[model samples]
Target: MSNTGKSLSDQAVQELVAKLKQAIATGTYQPGEWLKQIDVERSYNVNRFTVRSALSELHSNGFLQHVPYKGYRVTEHSLQERIAITEARELIECAAAARVIANMDSPGLQRLESLALEFRDALNAEDRPRMMKVNFAFHRCFNDYCRNPHLSRMVDELRERGVGNANRGWTKRSTQEASAQDHLDMVEALRDKNLVRLQALIHIHLNRWRQGYDSLSS
Candidate 1:
């Protein structure tokens, strides 16, 4: 059956997905927490089928695992896995930073600068989803000069995997300010063709997640 035009089923699944993704990202579900169908059905007031469908979406998105006999649980990334993802991201992003700097243009810079402002506004307004959306777009602006579609797609996939709950760190005002500064700093570096500074800021920007994850999981 077509669940089009905001059907009740589609809304349920969308709400479930957002809540589950936020829970998983913020470590509420933790690694290996069994996402019992009954629990989800009761909690979300959805049928078993809707819960299963929502879970399948999470599984496809690398947030959950469907084990042979254990059904579904939150996916766990080993230390090694995390490091590998971080390193791959750093490599691609740092290289892209250089290219972005080289190809820096007025229109692109304005767009990214505007996005940075929007991100700050989102944070100040406590709009988590908009903040994340703007932040992702800001970073994607830098990588636009990467040129290779395959590499860009890889970076995009890695980003999708690396993103966490936008609401997770809203209470940390200092961290948000620091991150906003980093984006503004990146824009400055691009305008000035300061590759070294741009690269350093990229590392700092990405390291926030690594450090936060380590602290949370450790």
Candidate 2:
């Protein structure tokens, strides 16, 4: 393949990886569900090489587990593992709150607020997939302000790892409402440049899903 051909192939693989990750995160692919390469090829209409590469990438990212003969399956975390991930998020996101606030300008703040409202609208419309997408966009915009690409990438990876388990809590209407409010309140904190309040809100928001998961488990 030429360099341009390889580039297109790489892009195709990355896109496939993202789509598969979203499917897993949204429960379209249940935990422990096997993902056969041939089935993926048929469903996605991609070549076998692309399917293999995409699956390999997801496996490296902790989104899938590979078995020699049986193929790949979505990874499932236990309660304890999920709690550890939540704590990691709190530590990183709360610590980064000040930086996030410092980097925000009026336009950036408006974008954040807009995304927050969009998330609420999705929630009100009971569009679970849209809600999830907007919620992710809201956070991604917020994290971009930290001005540390490596740190932002880590946050994204951690979020993807825990989203599957956290989604269980997101099913509750009350939990969803609280989360929507949390996003707006977070934007308010950014506008006011209240670092402490922002950190507190971040902690609370991160724990909301954990609380829901706990309630369900108990």
Give residue 12's error in model 2 in angstroms: 2.9
Would you estimate the TM-scores of all the predictions? Answer: 0.66, 0.90
Provide the overall lDDT of each model, using Cα atoms, as 2-decimal numbers. Answer: 0.75, 0.89
lDDT of 2: 0.89
Candidate 1: residue pairs that collide: none
Model 1: ten consecutive residues of lowest lDDT: 162-171
- Relative to the unseen true structure, what is the C-alpha lDDT of residue 40 in candidate 1, on a scale of 0 to 100? 87
Q: Model 2: residues >4 Å from true position, as ranges? A: 1-7, 214-218
Model 1 lDDT, full chain set: 0.75
lDDT of 2 at 212: 68
lDDT per residue as tens, model 1, 31-125: 66798899988887888878988999989888888988778987777656766776889988887776677777999899989999998998789
Off by over 4 Å in 1: 1-63, 68-74, 165-171, 210-218
